[model samples]
Target: MDNPVGMDNKPIARTNFGSNFKIIPTNDQIKELQTVIRDRSTSRSDFVFNADRLIRLVVEEGLNSLPYGDMDIITPTGETYNGLKFLKGNCGVSIVRSGEAMEQGLRDCCRSIRIGKILIQSDEDTHEARVLYAKFPEDIADRKVLLMYPIMSTGNTVIKAIKVLKDHHVKESNIILLNLFCTPSAVSMVTKAFPLMIVHTTEVHPVAPNHFGQKYFGTD
Candidate 1:
């Protein structure tokens, strides 16, 4: 199949990040919003609010990477207007707990989209990601999947989740990972392993606010 069509604006691919690793272009507004969430002194309410704003942006960018088909529709003026339809079905799979935080943003765009869950935890000793629970749509194999895992640090958890998707017959090329914050090292690691998969993130930094789940959920 042809590679998933990236955004018309195109995803920025820095030479160091390699191809298929798309960074959402950021501006002053995004920078300030990110700063609010990243600041340790920020209140939980502000953190969650600003975080959702960034997540929404990342979600929109991820949708742009999916394939679409052109269709002309008659407008109110009785004129044919060109429109586009998604090429195939899409379902979301969120890494349990943390990834669930992004579900609302995805739902905002896809009101009735199906979403699945995978629970993975890192072993304290080896620090390797282990999948404990997973539940997916019966027809996940036929749908384009948006894997929602906000913060990608070591990339171990994402790689583990991708393995599960592959076992379920989801094509590597058909999956789009909707992420908000990621470290450059983590991006490099994930891309090296799954070159065909698409990853859309707002920014790539050396360090990520891994406590995002706790802050967003008021657990911190």
Candidate 2:
């Protein structure tokens, strides 16, 4: 019955994105979000609503990590001061269906944001993420890509997403891996493969073994 007001309190960490990945929420809040999403007894409606709320918080927190510039401002008292403005070199792209589920959250927090869509699905046998669809703006290379995936299990989907983004000429530092739930192995796999890529996840669960000994999760 809690209002989900503290989802943005989850802790964050530094990966490959330099100072560009700074939204760090807390571990406690991350766990809370995961618990709500994973609870079998929760109604589908509640699940979707709560998950959306959490995703909004995540998006807002992520926005805070973006690079900013200083602007001159005059106060009501006639004093001059420097104010921070959001750096405008980034774009957001969500993995279809589940990833798109977070799109409204991103829109609510950003002004004049451009959203791209990619479809990646998990192979039932291999548990790998295969890209079924992708479409991006021609100017994507000039903007940071907020690659969104709702869950990070084996990291295959996100990896493929990154590959797509890179093929379009987007720099590694310009790609941020954003997810709702992630496993330690998933984070490690992506970071080890792409050191310059930064990741922002709500929570990291311990490893869960797949049929082929690979850590995996069920994605609908």
Candidate 3:
């Protein structure tokens, strides 16, 4: 918990938070599978597989940070082809426990990438987010950071975690939240707290699959 920045990244933004929110497009099949994860009758094996499949899309999009420009290459025909280049100084920081579940999908997207961890828990008395541990790349300030947490409920944990990053000199614009499902309240609170921050997710429902970590890790 070195240099924890108390709470919050900056003054809440007065602008609309919706513009900063990005949702992964879903079709009928994707929609049906999303429902599968929330069904209590689903078994652990099924739950883990389907959940992984769905979030894999989100993970890829967030990691790729898509639709690049400026780089061009030549094919065998000698014709120029425009393409995207993966930016250097990119790293991921996952909030421990539940957030750890999204780690593998991230690795799959970037094989040699470095990953960081931050462990935040709620104080029993104060009911506030408390950072117990944090570790990041030495040059994290220069790197684009992805906060890999699946679900956002009250958003207290995420707000606190972002503060920790800001303390270490990570710019709000350089940070992207990779989430699977979040409520409108969670989305609004987080986007307002750090307006420049970007959020990528699959769905924004009234209820998140909060049981995600428990079931994904087989704790249930």
Alpha-carbon TM-score of each model against the true structure: 0.91, 0.78, 0.86
5-124 per-residue lDDT for model 3 (tens digits) = 112423333235556677776678667777899899999999989988877788887865632447899999999998877857888899988888888888888888899999999876
RMSD of 2: 6.9
**Which candidate gets the maximum TM-score versus the true structure?**
1
**Clashes per model (N, Cα, C within 3 A):** 0, 7, 0
Of the two candidates 1 and 2, the one with more favorable TM-score, higher being better, is 1
Q: If ranked by TM-score, best first, what sequence of candidates would result?
A: 1, 3, 2
Tens digits of per-residue lDDT, candidate 2, 35-115, equal: 767766656666666677778777876676578899999999999998988888778999766677777788888868898
Of 1 and 3, which scores higher on TM-score?
Answer: 1
lDDT agreement with native, every candidate: 0.86, 0.69, 0.82
Instruction: Compose the digit string of candidate 1's lDDT tens values, residues 18-109.
Output: 57777677678987987898899999988988988988998998899877999999999999999998776889999988999999999999
Q: Which is superior by lDDT, 1 or 2? A: 1
Give candidate 1 regions above 4 Å deviation: 1-16
